[model samples]
Target: MAQDFDIRGATVFSGLTPDDFTALAQVGRRESYLPGETVFSGNLRAQSFFVIADGGVEVLRREPDGSQTILARMGRGAAFGEAALLDGHPRRALGIAKGSTTCWVLDARGLARLRAEQPVVATRLVANLARGMAVRLVRASTRATQVVDQRRAANSSLGAGEARRSLMDRLFGR
Candidate 1:
């Protein structure tokens, strides 16, 4: 049954060493969600971090007008809700399975258990998680800056299309 669980394709775990990967596999479990299923909702207590093994998920932000904006679309190998595992916090956005999706889910409580039983593995997991969070923060900050710049440019004499293209080029490495 454990052999069926695969983390090799996941970016978050791909960088892990043999022992680190083994430790992760011991605690992680593969879970599936159907189309339109709410994996977790904004403001709810985040229970687990997920790494997409197959399919996609969307992180959504709800505005005051009750309209939702896609904050991000997570594809295969992408990780989400990882920050919640490290720090106890409510979810910042809604994560919805875009379709029938397979994900490797790691429960925070499971990690706590592993920490008690295997301190070394716990240490590796913590370090890996920290690095992942740091990388994510950097990416998010860069994207946020681009968004602000795009809006600023659009409001100026610069046309929306040109502003958007310039922002995309700056963000996407053209």
Candidate 2:
């Protein structure tokens, strides 16, 4: 947070001091994406994470039958590709820009610099990322449970001449 770069809207970067912000901004750079452009591809090794500064992003999951499902719509202040913060894991989904989106992009080299030179800032960042990811995981789990419960009820209430289909199938009609 130079006296200029704003970090207040970003929950994953919350509680960081001014010095922390300066260090973070030093390592990461701002990048913009055009509408429908990919920020990161699914199934590839992830090297960075992004914090949206403007516009929106669609987090899409690749399906078994070659379909893509929109998992989330992220707007300003949202962080995506979070798994990249901890490891070089294959991304589980794709993130594409919904419009003229700008983001603070942090890659492995920058992260390494922060960890070595600004350990306190790095720890705070990692802790924040983990906390945010845990919350998201919990929400996803709750939604999945609700879907299962709904399917069970639907299956039991099936009427004659009707067939059962999954929630995804019904929503996507695929």
Candidate 3:
């Protein structure tokens, strides 16, 4: 099944040679998920990294109120769960299939094997993961700043309304 999907086109596998990609692909197990099915959940032990081969997936974070906020929508060729693959930490978000999705899963054991046997490919993968993560962080920070600015503008408008109300009250004694 993995052989049917090409890993060479993925950004993380960009620098790898054809043979290296074949070896890496060999380590992956392909799985399909039905619509609305969970690919993985938050706070669970991270077992594997995933590359979307077909359909779509949503990455979501559960709020304290139990509502889930979507963090990202992934399409074909997108790679996710790299941080967990590296550190073996608990998952920070939930992954759900938006449709009938196909994914190539590479667990920690497979990553270790690839690192040992194809060090060059592993290095490129790691670099790509880091680059992807950094871009996400920057985008998040920018969004945070935008939210703060919006709130400030709203508060200023509210303050102006209050000031107008105070002046009207003073003049009319209401």
Candidate 4:
């Protein structure tokens, strides 16, 4: 049954036709990772894009203080590492298994070969990747704006308290 699993819902394969999706799935390799195991680390050369087949993976950002912040917790059908696979750049974040996890991996070489053999499928895949990236960017921008607004509100409240303190000092001569 797993062999017939459809990848159409995965972001990387979102726009692909059924036939294209099936063809791509045939080329994907399955990989498993144990809990706390690193699936891929930041700054390493990205060799493949992955879609979670089961369980969970945590995408993390490592701070200068040697601590890690989770950027995302991905479940089944979530895809990652497309940016590096598309651009041939080093990975920007670490991917670690949150539990016993399985991923369907598609290497860059395989993707290139697919693109050469089936340009239309490749085009749809790339377009879907771009759309996914745009959505993430928009969400990040929205979160940043919300954070800034919260800080401004907190500062204004603090300023009001300070004003009250100053008025009290003047009236009480303290």
* Local distance difference test values of all predictions, in order: 0.76, 0.81, 0.79, 0.76
Quote the positional error of residue 84 for candidate 4 in Å: 1.7
Q: Give residue 101's lDDT in candidate 3 (0 to 100).
A: 93
Candidate 4 wrong stretches, greater than 4 Å: 1-6, 43-47, 145-174
Alpha-carbon shift of residue 25 in model 4 (angstroms): 3.0
Per-residue lDDT of 1-174 in model 2, one digit per residue for the tens?
Answer: 333435456998889886888898789888778999888785432568888888888989889999989989999888877776677775777888999988888888888999999999999999998998899899999998898778868776885334466666667787
- For lDDT, candidate 1 versus 3, the one ahead is 3
In terms of lDDT, model 3 sits at 0.79
Model 3: per-residue lDDT, tens digit, 95-151?
999999988888888889989988887887778878878887899889977866676
Q: List per-candidate RMSD values in Å.
A: 6.9, 5.7, 8.7, 8.8
TM-score of each model, in listed order: 0.73, 0.75, 0.74, 0.73
**Over 4 Å off, model 3:** 43-47, 144-174
Q: Spell out the clash pairs found in candidate 2.
A: 1-21
Runs of candidate 1 with Cα error greater than 4 angstroms are 15-19, 43-45, 142-174
RMSD of 3: 8.7
Off by over 4 Å in 2: 1-5, 43-45, 64-66, 144-174
Question: In candidate 1, what are the lDDT values of residues 1-174, reduced to their tens digit?
Answer: 155655575656555567766676777788888998887875443668888887899989888999999999988888877778878776768888998988887878878877987788788767777888898889999998887786676756665665555555666878
Residue 21's lDDT within candidate 2 is 86
